[model samples]
Target: MDLQSDLPPLCVTCGVCCTDAFFRYSCVTPEESARIHSLGFPVEREDGREIFSHPCTRLCGASCTVYEQRPATCREFRCTTLSALEEGAIDRPEADRRVSLLRAAVQAVRQLLPKEEKIWALRARLYADPAAAPQTRLALLSMDILADRYFKLKGRRFFS
Candidate 1:
């Protein structure tokens, strides 16, 4: 049921990462700095502080406007590459719990995210393989512990 291991790559071309959907995007290095500028965007400014926002205006029709000159954040923000996303370590019961926890966390972060059927599909996949990823399996176990503790502390079930 480990979804990450069995599911093929899902390119979320919907631009969720580009907008203020979950987290803000920023660049620090000179190369990244250059990349942002190359996109024909002005440096993000807030209350006298330079800050970047997500969902760059450069996105056009479900794609990056400046693909080659995109910022380093866009380049490195490939979460699908995470070991958790890989097939090997994603089939344990803990892995199932981790996927469930991730789904809860993601839904808590953005209800719209769960509306995407991809979430349900991935949730079903967390137990697809049992012997592939031990470390991820352990991390998933820890995430389950944290998720349970979080629910107890908050007094509300995120998924329920």
Candidate 2:
């Protein structure tokens, strides 16, 4: 039996959650913080809670290097599309379609952004810059809409 094949393709191949696509930081328990820090990824303290910023160093082409030992948040999180697919609210094709759309949207935004600049920084700049390209603003909006609709939990996305 091919157990891996039975799993959702989007979760395995589309690792937007590991990137800066949706969130800036993920909350972790104190123990998770210690372990993740030991693994050489910097953990920060925020409002007495421990967090690790995204675009995770452990991600290598959509795969987590420390997947088995990843933080509890990483282990437990399920994007809205994944949840819908698992719950039979949407079929595999639809889930995959959503993933593809989000990926393309991210790519559009990435192409419009300056090299090495963070997405959040770009968003801030775009928001304040009156003369920014219309295409860039449109790309940002497309990415944000897809991320909000398919991945982010209600009221939980960055800059929401």
Best by TM-score: 2
List the candidate 2 regions with Cα displacement exceeding 4 Å: 1-9
User: Residue 69, candidate 1: how far off, in angstroms?
Assistant: 2.7
lDDT of 2: 0.80
TM-score against native, each model: 0.39, 0.85
Query: In candidate 1, which residue ranges exceed 4 Å CA deviation?
Result: 1-12, 45-50, 80-160
Give the per-residue lDDT digits (tens) of candidate 2, residues 39-145.
87778788888877878778887678787788898888888998997788987778888988998898888887788876777888888997888998889889988
